[model samples]
Target: MLTERKHTLILIILLVSLPVFALLHLNSGQIDLGIGTMIDSMFSFNNENMNEVIAREIRIPRMLTALLVGGSLSIGGLLMQTLFRNPLAGPYVLGINSGSSLFVAFTIMTGVTFFQSDLGMIINALIGAFLFGLLILFFAGMVRNQISLLLVGIMLGSFTSAFISILETMSHAEELKVYMLWSLGSLQKVEFHQLGIISLIVFLGLIGALLISKQLNLLVLGEREAKSLGLNIKRIRYLIIGITALLTGVITAFCGPIAFVGLAVPNMVRILFKTQHHIVLITASFLLGAIFVMSVDAILQLLESWMVIPINAITSIIGAPIVVIIVFRRLR
Candidate 1:
């Protein structure tokens, strides 16, 4: 049990470290711009300056994308784990990303001009994620076993992948190329202009998650207890699903299916904080999640001279070990 002062101190450290890390991330690129110039670019509209342009157009958006994607997925993961009362549950593992991807494939591979636009893709992704979330909830009611539920989720993912494979085969070469690149995942794909809407969506999801923090904490005591406390269990479950879908869908729409942040970060938060308090968990997850992805991306940028690694691959590399450790503990 952490003291309140300790929690406050930890939260303050995380809050302060975010912008500092963002600065470091901005400086990690190939062009060695001074800190002053980079800072200036954020405020000043100096289109003629190449360094400022790079900072404004490329680095800023990528950094912000990593921040938003990391935080959103972590929260989504937290929600899924809480809703299911399972340590391993997450948007990625339970096929929410697969659902979003399947819809994105439909939008991209169909060669519809309107659907290829950012707005079109976001809408489709949200619908797919929401429907899949409901589907997962439905199955949760049917099965008594967590492992069985996880297996069903895996099967759902495989089913979606098979459909995607079919789309890849029948699609035009250009369309196929586009989808392939997107599926590989890249934070650099997001632009400065897109950040506004992305931030807004993430903000809304975060607010929703926070508003239900009390309900989430009650849920930690078990569904029956929560219901006995006059917590509308069904409504809370639906809300969690909706918020999870929104957070997961938007991130997937922009960042592709980032694996394991949703699973790994929230678990890390739980382990580090050792608390079942949703407010603390959510806040820590939001900050730490951003910090985690930003750190990975910064390392990648530093190594960009030698090689480029996909963001998805690196997160999976880091998250997989955590998952294994968790499973081992659960087995014991």
Candidate 2:
């Protein structure tokens, strides 16, 4: 009963904060819509005379993208932590982000067409991430040692990164410019339709994650223990990896390999909640991740108004120090 009440409180807090953060996001930008105009535009029942088009078309899509991407990355991170039983495990650990990056680089540089459309870029990225994730899963099945699996994943990431470097070196200046910009990451690029697709994919992934929450909780007790408890360890592992791959792939396809959100937010939630339950951890991580990204976006706009700084630059600037502190504290 207490646990249920606690979760209810958390949910209420998240529900309240989400809209406030969203409103802040809407009001923030180069153009000041003001609170009244922003509210009017949001409802679409009023502010018909104001810049309703800009609010609905531009800021709304961007805010939705932030929410979806942030939530997706956080859930992916939670799954990674459970799968690997490592605090540092994240979407990037299995080379999934690298896979997406490689595909995006190929699209930008070689103009490789998957479906003969710009959406081909996202398709190719999903392919790369899925394949890489499968390879990692295969190796994990073969290896009983956690450290070995970690090393293999790191090596795979390095291999994919080397391939991206090769493509970068061979690409023309124009192609390189496009690739570089994509690598920096931005939530502003998603159109309303694209946001719909992303939201759908993320929603499905989160549902899958929720369904496997019991299995994840078991897996946290160790593979042997999980098996002894009648859990299908192999099948559960594969399912988790596959779902995580899909989530990471889709997000990376659009957001350009957002870093550290997956690694940091789960740990932060664990520290705050002081529980290892997948249900609570997953929900908290999602909400916290959304809050974190929205906060970062808000900071980026504030900083951009003061100086021209890329969103990626601001994220790295803020994320790196926090990571370092976490590492230092862990060492002590």
Quote the positional error of residue 189 for candidate 2 in Å. Answer: 0.9
Q: For residue 41, what is the lDDT in candidate 2?
A: 67
Off by over 4 Å in 2: 1-4, 35-50, 113-118, 138-154, 325-332
Tell me, by lDDT, which candidate is best. Answer: 1
lDDT of 2 by residue, 143-239 (tens): 8665567688789878887888898899888889888888888888777668777777788888899889989999999989999999998798778
Q: Which ten residues in a row have the lowest lDDT in candidate 2?
A: 44-53
In candidate 1, which residue ranges exceed 4 Å CA deviation? none
For candidate 2, give the lDDT of residue 295: 79
TM-score of each: 0.97, 0.88
Candidate 1 local lDDT, 89-175, one digit each (tens): 999999999999999999999988888888999999999999899999999999877777888889999999999999999999999
Relative to the true structure, candidate 1 has a C-alpha RMSD (angstroms) of 1.3
